[model samples]
Target: MSDYKLGLDYALDQDRKDELKSYRNQFHIPKDKQGDAWIYMTGNSLGLQPKQTKAYVNQELNDWANLGVEGHFEAKNPWLAYHEFLTESMAKVVGAKPIEVVVMNTLTANLHFMMVSFYKPTKTRYKILIESDAFPSDKYAVESQLRHHGFDDKEGVVLWKPRPGEELLNYDDLETILETQGDEIALIMIGGVNYYTGQYFDLKRITQLGHKQGCNVGFDCAHGAGNVALNLHDSGADFAVWCTYKYLNSGPGSLAGCFVHERHAYRKDLNRFTGWWSHNKQTRFNMRGEFDQLPGAEGWQLSNPPILSMAAIKASLDLFNEVGMDKLINKSKKLTGYFEYLLKQLGEDTIRIITPKRSEERGCQLSIQVKNADKSLHNKLTEVGIISDWREPDVIRCAPVPLYNSFEDVYRLVEKLKGILK
Candidate 1:
């Protein structure tokens, strides 16, 4: 509604005014056969690679070629401390303290590792709670945890479901669930932003509510990490995990991040799986001393990290550190707001936006429900060089990442949809 117009000129004018417009040049936007750039809107899935990523990765390759074993300590960045290079910038991107964050493992692997420490369920309080529509990987991880703990997976899982016919979750319903069965639930693991609806939950509220009921709370922030202001430390959640391949733009299946609140930084009593990398660095080469677990989130590490993968992460984090989340989020709100405005102009009867209307309650992605449409609609969109993601029955998830996407990309997307629907 901010006096948005339905024309290419308006989008071009907005792009011209965008300070982040220069960033689009940093990425190599995919091109179709005719050499035109495809309107890439799936940053929420796998982010586009930064043009600098190859050079960053090549530096590690060259260091490895020049120095084999000595590269561990002699390389420019030093392989022995590669993960440390990303800690500060990664912490800043997620609004966490340096002691609270570490980059290691894939998303699901970090979830299980975190669960080994956090999901300590007594027989009386063995049930786990999660959104009914959580990503399949998370559901599988939680269910496996229940089975490993000698509990009935089916009976031990409690779902915070949306009301009949609705897509978004209701907080009141979650309160009612906790009020009645809070003591029986040992862990409340939820996606920070529901991937299907693009609805960002109030992490602090959920944490406080779960704590009042004597339950441990954590989040799978795969969808919320770089796209929204998570402020994981301020939320006081027990732990959180997310992948770097999404908004972090660190390539596919790159290292994921784990956040262990400062309160749990030094707790030796926590039951966690550990490996050689978790030992004190100074004594690590001794290979003969007692196991001294490092303090803070790094204590959870199980293996030496891959420098090539960490190189991609370092490349992406450098950009994030330069831009800062405050400015990125400011542009995200406006870009997504513009996408929503254009979709609303398509008429409610023709399509519906399942993502929360308030900019603060969602991120860059908008989940659109086209009336009576099937996956063929998504197929049609793809056929025309628009790259958007399609959820099972009908939702087309489009994310106009402020770092690379432009207002004109969004404008062209709507025009393509209109033509197909007509």
Candidate 2:
């Protein structure tokens, strides 16, 4: 990584040597009016569509057209057990056992559902803890959960904030908060990778800390799945939820994934809201049978999933299974390291990266804090051909997604950013 040189030829050379270089052709890269590809750096927000997604979706459509209701059992993938098809591949993506993972519901809905089983509150231990600047939606969900349980939302919530003027969170700060307020906290919910700062937290450390306090722990891995090695099973969290739209490359508003540790899989004593889909598959068709909840994460499903959306996920996951996380993460470090190298060359006085400098502490996204710059700077980048996310006031969140983004793409992005900064 230190050998990265500043020139177009260097980028071309890196791309040529990249083992995963051919993956870029699998996606449908966006183009301008002149047919030039945009420097897309917003996979943190929404990933580019896979070229194979259309064919996968079309297969489901064709099955639906021919089989109709019978497609539930007769279709090639079979809608009756369709979500089951996604369980194994997705578990691999998140580093969990096949029994612990399930694909169902959208992101926030899955978060809410996971809360139903994990967020057990009482008169004294009623507090819920989260990061200070959690994604706005997660903040809203936790606050609403507090209100729903008849506690004062403000008093029931605890925020683990960063030190003054600092952007990234320190684990020491999190530990300090738990030490002081551990007794009062019933649940600890945090973003696996902070959306704004792109800080990938230590899931295992947080889970161990929460468990030591007798608090249930969970993660909203909306930004971690398919982007980083979450190792959810090893983290030993009570539960987790993540969307497939971002790094997983499922379409917008696609179904999300949920994980329940194997220890809790057969624990029928745990309280949860259930539906017919949560019942045992053998008795699912028989209305007379009482609710015998299916074991593991599948026990959380409420209804049969959408086949088309699952098909898109299947398409992306098939590719993931082929390449594996080890290979993707290896290339990701080099591409992102090269990007950070180029950004630093712009000068620390001008460009300030708020994300952690260490590769293990972050995924591909870098939150660049451009001094004195505003939204217009982002607009200018967009006008030229860069697709990135602009947070309120100052940060530009750029993710050089390893699956589709090339070393040349990262080089061009930094070059364009340099022009804008100048």
What would the per-residue lDDT of candidate 2 be over residues 197-277, giving only the tens digit for each residue? 999999999999999999999999999999999999999999999999999999898989999999999999888889888
lDDT of 2 at 98: 97
Give the winner by lDDT: 1
Please provide, for model 1 over 1-422, each residue's C-alpha lDDT reduced to its tens digit, 9 standing for 90 to 100. 47788799999999999999999999989999999899999999999999999999999999999999899989989999999999999999999999999999999999999999989999899999999999999999999999999999989999999999998899999999999999999999999999999999999999999999999999999999889999999999999999999999999899999999999999999999998888998898899999999999999999999999999999889999999999999999989999999998989999999999999899999999999999999999999999999998889999999999999999999999999999
Whole-model lDDT, model 2:
0.93
Off by over 4 Å in 2: none
Cα error, candidate 2, residue 163 (Å): 0.3
User: Per-residue error at 65 for model 2, in Å?
Assistant: 0.8
- Clash count list over all predictions: 0, 0
Task: List TM-scores for all candidates, in order.
Answer: 0.99, 0.99
Model 1 scores worst on lDDT over the 10 consecutive residues at: 1-10
The local lDDT score (0 to 100) that residue 363 gets in candidate 2 is: 96
Candidate 1 residue 176 C-alpha distance from true site, Å: 0.6
